[model samples]
Target chain A: MRHLTDDEIQGYLDNHPDSDREKIRAHLDICGQCRSNLENYQIIAGQLNTDHIPALSPGFTDAVLSAIKPDTQDVPVEEPSRLIAWMSAAAVFILGIASTIYFTGSSVAKNIIALFSPANITEPSFVSRYKEYISGIDLDLTLVFAVALVLAVIALIDRMIKRRHKPVSFMI
Target chain B: MDDKTSIVRKIVAGDKRAFRLLVDEYQRLVNHIAFRMVSNPGDREDICQDIFMRVYQNLAGFRHDSRLSTWIARIAYNCCIDYLNKNNIPFIDEEFDETISNMPGGSITPEQQLYKSDISNLLQKEIGLLPVKFRAIITLYHLDEMSYAEIGDIMSMPEGTVKNYLFRARRLLRDRLMLKYGEEELRQ
Candidate 1:
């Protein structure tokens, strides 16, 4: 009869389901070499099966807790309601500005053109009139509103992208 | 809600105490993976901290698809792999036989092998000489008491591969032990 392979011996000692224990036992009755191999593997497996976790540094939990304290900036996921609220705010702001421009007939583009015109610059009253123009013109408010809208849109897109690709450290 | 979901919710809600509880719960599992994969003594603690930080950072993304411990263990394993790569250590040593064959002989006597403590110490030493992947498989299997399926999930390998590597690692450890102190001595 052929001797048991090392895999067979180790598997038998490990109590592996695939190992035929009765047949191996019958074989062991006739084979001393395979039994010896099984005994050696048994010793090693016994040592390994015991819990032998290496010691971590004292206060490991404390250290990790403290390390994560300042670093745990939880970026809340944007809910649909919240996204809608932002969009609504942007829409209302734009609509309000458009309505003001439409109803008041304040032509911001025409004022800008008038301010930069050479004819307006060459006049002696240009500085005071320009100061008055700068103070009274709605272009500043419109410009401010437009800048704020651009910023808000950029921030919203950035948050969406971040949410979509939030650094998945390890996906199972 | 389940304990895991509750803790995860509390953690995601900026509850530091809940996060602390999580750290306390899974620190051993994380430390085991880190200690097995990372050889440097100093980097071990740092790597553990890094793993937890990543866990905290990404907890919101966890969808309860697996056990929390298994998920944290996966992070720890990946962090150690990153450390090994950054430090230019080959994660899988190609010439692993040289590692075993080159082990100094007769350094451990049969008398030393008689003591369980001595045998465990020698076993740890021999395990350290294994390739990185094998060492991790051994650690997760024996120390962590994880199933082959769970280990396969963490290491991103099939269950069969984990079992095979585990068998090979044990066989290698046995060979090394028998080489240092002969088979009859180990039977004692």
Candidate 2:
């Protein structure tokens, strides 16, 4: 029989059935050189099996622990409630309008008062002045733009907060 | 829960003590893989620390499909590969080329070199001189006692490839041992 190849010997050593281990075994019984080769392979395998695993240096665990930031570092930032933010913006807008009316005098104030009073809404002078103010300012579009700006600011703040909570490695 | 699951859960729950336990438990495995892949002794500790730090960061994503050690080893293997790539080191696996110089023998005096002539130290030194892929296969198979399948997962190779690499690595190591120390010296 031909000598067992190194691969076959390795397979036999590893207990792989692909090697026809029994055939190699039988051959080894009759062949001195093949037996010696097998012995050599076994010795090498033995050394590898017994290879030393180097120990970690003292305080290695502590060193690793210290290197890792605390889990709290990754905690998601607490976002301000969106509803509360919107309500605060609305309150500020209303207060600004009320202060403007208070400072601008009774003519504009009466017009503003007339706009809120359903009974006086159809009075011709008050209605003409209110219509003039509405036509001049385009209040509907202004409200839409103001609402959009507030939403954009809220989204920007949300994104910044989320970005800050991203893992530190990502920043690096 | 099994010990691994318990440890993983605790770690995920933000337990620093459990994270410490994890580092204590797997430091040797990580260090072994790192030492085998990275020939520079100075880089091994940093690599190990980086591996565990990554594990901590990604702990929440680890599914229990494989052993926890296997997962950690996979991370270690990938980190070493990245390090090699970043440093532009070529990974040679097929034949042992003696022309390529081994890593510098940092801080080893002549006396230390003489004392390191023991078979084990010589064997380890030779293993370190091997290409990173061969060193990793030998480390996973022999030192870590990992199965070929697990090694395949860790190294991202097929099981057949894992077996082939294991056989080739051992044969190369044996040949190196025979050439340097002779058959008689190996018989010991």
List DockQ, one per candidate, in order.
Answer: 0.28, 0.35
Give the range where candidate 2 chain A is weakest over 10 consecutive residues by summed lDDT. Answer: A163-172
Clashing pairs in 2: none
Docking class of 2: acceptable
TM-score of each: 0.68, 0.72
Interface RMSD, prediction 1: 4.3
lDDT of 2 by residue, A1-172 (tens): 6888888778888887677877888988999887888888888777788848677789889898777765464465466667756755765665566456556854796776667877834567876798788769734535655765666566567667767766554211
lDDT of 1 by residue, B1-188 (tens): 99999999998887778988998888888888888888888888889889998998889999999999889999899989889889998987655564555755436566555654478778877777788999898888877788888999999999888888888888888888887777766776
| Regions of model 2 farther than 4 Å from truth | A70-94, A105-172, B93-117, B180-185
What does the lDDT read for residue A71 in candidate 2?
47
Model 2 lDDT, residue B121, Cα: 71
Report model 1's chain A TM-score: 0.42
Whole-model Cα lDDT of every candidate shown, in order? 0.79, 0.77
Candidate that scores best on lDDT? 1
Question: How many pairs in model 2 have backbone atoms within 3 A of each other, for residues 3 or more apart or on separate chains, i.e. clashes?
Answer: 0
Candidate 2: C-alpha RMSD to true structure equals 8.1
